[model samples]
Target: MPIYSSDSDNETMPRTKLFGRQRPIRSVLGGGQVADVLLWENKGVSAALSIGMTILWFLFEVAEYSFVTLFCHISITAMLVVFIWCTSAEIFNWTPPEMPTSILDKSTFHEFASTFHERFNQALSSFVDIACGKQPALFFAAIFCLYILSVIGNYFTFLNILYLCFVCLQTLPFLYNKYEDKVERYAGELTREVKKMFRRMNSNVLSKIPRGPVKEKKAR
Candidate 1:
């Protein structure tokens, strides 16, 4: 099996998948930069995110620090450092660090807002449909998931959940990218078993269920 890569930019090269994946792992991950970080191609960024999450988890989960308290402490420390740096720079006739407005301009904010708006609208539409019972199976699935999450929430703090999710996100993608051939074989077998069970259920159980008459829409 040819290992997938962001470097496989040639149009003639056929895209590979483990089972049902359409795009390259890099494309699924967004782009080369994101794939690089996740795949350990960029060790610096991966390490930074890992270390940052660990520290945050330690502070919030282990230390039991409130977000407000942490924010205040961070702000005070940052402001104090800036103040001291400015004062020292003035006394020693040295240049001080300055942030440019161009770092986060209107275009970037607009792009972010647009992306958020699209995703939020999509989620809102799905939520509305699920709540309205447009699809009974989907509605029940959502309910089941929410109930499970509620039960889990009772035991795990938000920070714990977030940290766990972060760890999984960091690890799973890399593992899948590396050992995708083996994973694909396992996934293929699992999928076949699941489909087989579903077929049996449909034939043995679901096929016996009574169906209501279809309501035909009247022409105005």
Candidate 2:
């Protein structure tokens, strides 16, 4: 039996058609209509903001501001927003139009906290499984090495290395959209090569390892 109805299904399922392919350049850089008018709606404005933010990062570098201070300021601003929202909605009967009253409500915070905690635990468990789970010893070791490198990056980071990524986010998508077919062809070729390399490695090295207790089924 086919997974999709013959009449309804065309080249792709509705959900796949929506999300699986590269998003339209217009839709992505914000040509699509939205109920809210956020900063990212216009491509030109988005590009300008990214450039401005990159310049600000350069200024911060010249000023010798630490990453700790940069992150602290962001945290403080977020806390201030929460404080103002709670106080205004509860005591003054005044709430900013932009700040939703639902977010300030006590029950809403509890539900958000519960959901966040659940997701965090799920992510942590998945990471642990990848590092120490039933995978071959060599694969687990490789993951562990990558985790160590990620931890080391925290200590050696510079301002440009951190914020340049955000700057690239603004421009890279537009470029990709313009040259999507060429980019995808290259990506497909690269992926096939990587898969071939991994298969060879598995046959020559990983397959030699004996199954450890990590992969053993628990007697039920």
Candidate 3:
């Protein structure tokens, strides 16, 4: 009898499931040779662009009333013209737009619901476990900080604060990750110096304090 190898069988198998039922989506829209170009491929370029855009947005509102009006007028008119021409038989013949399809079909609603339900339950359980775990000082501090922000947010636009946070999250994480090794080393050195300082203070205090039981000197 010949022994069948699982690895060989797996390697020979085709990725037919995606194509079997529903048509597989192309990696790039409109089947272009080059796939999507990422705006943030380079962290430095992304940071520069973000800063420039933010400054420009602040100095002169990018979506000024006149600019927004012009944009809306042009886009809406073009879309309307194309849509009417496509629908009417009196003009150039064109088919009605196809209804967009989703990865999860209506038929798979039950499966989608079950999957989300399971995921939500797992997330809730994990969150509770973390919240109840040892060393929750940072976690509680974060909650307190958020509460303070929420209370004081009545004075300023909450949306503005949220947007600033969004920008920081995008920009800061990349920069930190790039220089993480140096940051860790510096932090480690600082921690050691702090520990040494405390140790020295502790030793000096102990030396100054009387350690042994003293015999009373006779009426000196």
Candidate 4:
């Protein structure tokens, strides 16, 4: 004999099925139109702010102060570089491959630091692509050479030497592909661990049941 009957199964069937046929074209089209409108609105706002900043920069430059002018120029240049790097990164989705187990088994801090370094390099690469028209090796070489020149010109002042070290570090991306791969692997592992921890905690709580007395047992 079956534990459940056909009528019982039908009664237990969900009011709303979990899986069903896809929606009609009219519904999808309406959703797409809403998304398009949102996108356009966001872009329009960004453009307006960008134009406003440019106008403000121009006004600042018109004021006859050398310090203000220099500050404005540097700030604007930095903003442009950041904006370009971010936009290019988003467009390319330049995420590297996961790190191998051999690499990630090392120190956690070292792995996380490496991941940060890799992201920084990717950002720099995007900037180089825009500046040098996508010749990565040449771009790196030019940057390295400039750092060398700056150090030599400054006669190895502490600040200049520090800057040169940073330049060399940034140029590492051009030399080895494995760095980005390792970073990605470490990041993935960390994410997996976090999710697993949360899941374990959730399961532990869910497995606990409230204690209650049965009617016959309580009566006894």
- Give the winner by TM-score: 1
lDDT of 3 by residue, 1-220 (tens): 3233354454454433221333322221112211111124454645665776576455334344355666678799988986776678445565655555775366446644665576688768756765776548656875788799988788756445755775774555444445655655556556556656666666677557877888888995
Q: Which portions of model 4 miss their true places by more than 4 Å? A: 1-66, 69-178, 206-220
Model 3 scores a TM of 0.37
Error of 2 at 193 (Å): 1.7
Model 1: per-residue Cα lDDT at residue 137: 84
Q: What's the lDDT for residue 8 in model 2?
A: 32
Compare the candidates by lDDT and give the number of the best one. Answer: 1
lDDT per residue, candidate 4, 44-136, as tens digits? 543554465455444544443455766788799988987777777778996543434573234544644665676688778777675665776
Model 1: C-alpha RMSD to truth? Answer: 9.4
Q: How accurate is candidate 4 locally (lDDT)?
A: 0.51
The predicted structure with the larger TM-score, 1 or 2, is: 1
Stretches of candidate 2 off by over 4 Å are 1-41, 65-158, 203-220
Clashes found in each candidate (C-alpha, N, C closer than 3 A): 0, 0, 0, 1
The alpha-carbon lDDT assigned to residue 201 of candidate 1 equals: 77
Candidate 2: residue 83 lDDT (0-100): 83
Least well predicted 10-residue stretch by lDDT in candidate 3: 28-37
C-alpha root-mean-square deviation, each candidate = 9.4, 13.2, 18.3, 26.6
Candidate 1 minimal-lDDT segment of 10 residues: 1-10
For all predicted structures, in order, the TM-scores are: 0.62, 0.41, 0.37, 0.19
State the TM-score for model 1: 0.62
